[model samples]
Target: MSQPQAGRGTFITFEGIDGSGKSTQARLLAEHLRAQGHDVILTREPGGSPGAEEIRALVLQGDPDRWSAETEILLFTAARRDHLERTINPALAVGKIVVCDRFADSTRMYQGLSRGDLRATVDQLHSLMIGREPDLTVLIDMDPDTGHARAKSRQTAEERFEDFGANLQAQMRAGFLSLAQEFPERFRIIDGARAIDSVATDVAQTVSTHLSSVG
Candidate 1:
């Protein structure tokens, strides 16, 4: 992975199947960094900026078949472009550590691989519009059944993806692990099946090592 430009802030993203606890981990990491006197911004994809948030509602709610795989990819890419322009890049330019709940990698799995074999289209669009990748990505690996149950228990309108069923969750879990291998330089795998505190400890340690090495 390419290093961030000099004077740029670190970009850290969390990724996993729904209910894998990535969002919680992202929040905790942001808080941890802030308490340690580091400037941090906690955000999430599909909805970091106002415009992107609007798009987020479109893609995250509604029936599972509301949008075609191709359309979903376009929607996600648009949101990401807006997010980078309005939120992520500005923060990084100012040297604030940005902790994001999910990034392009989620799209890679959900829209690119899962919906169909559109990974190439996803990559092409990504390179042309938004070319940034996270400095570090934490993958919270979890069992599909457990993650699916947790996601359903929430009963949120954004359960569109979770509505795909446990099979998709299993597929997503496998896809994420494969993605980690594909980007070993910036990806860290954390076992999310453990207690919340234990998982957070592992995440914290992993990020601390990354920060120290980069510094």
Candidate 2:
């Protein structure tokens, strides 16, 4: 089902809808690990690597109309390949624990939920193409509509994905929750409606527990 699909070191991912507080909490997790004197690498999908970042702008800013879902998937996979080869894998090779804000999971939920057909193949490719997954994933689950509002409240200007409808966002949220259910050991879903520190604490604890188990 996966290509090689295995590797050295632990990969940790952060997932959620637009306003799920994943980025902030992912940083907190990385900091917490570093405080424990563990090496931690922080990165993100579709952008962390230089090449990936270039593609990121195209995917995020390019006209969604001119692009087919298949085209979008290929672009994302291309970025992922660049990210893994240039950034993620190298960091892992050095034995550092990586805390990534989004990864293959983002692809699954966003692309899967948006497309009406050929969804399963995209899902299959996501799991199969990537050779590594986070040893733990902290999903900040929230109502996509509320999440969109929250995201808008924070941003000065919205990105392309952020401009989508509540319905699409809801489907994405459903996709994320379904993914969590399928990978019990890999996902730790956290309530994201509370204050930031409260959410951070939950994320920190989950990372702590996963790290302890690994150690």
Q: Which lDDT tens digits does candidate 1 get at residues 1-215?
A: 33223338999999999989999999999989999999999999889999999999999999999999999999999898888888898899999999999999999999999999999999998887888799999999999999999999999889999999999999999999999999999999999999999999999999999999988
- Alpha-carbon lDDT of model 1: 0.93
TM per model? 0.96, 0.90
Q: Where's the lowest-lDDT run of ten residues in candidate 1?
A: 1-10
Candidate 2 lDDT over residue span 1-215, tens digit each: 33433447788999999887889888887887899898888998778899999988887773446467777888888888778877788877778888889988887777755765656867676666666667888899888889888776775432667766577778888889999998998999999889889998888888778778877
Candidate 2: stretches off by over 4 Å: 1-6, 156-158
| Global lDDT of each candidate | 0.93, 0.80
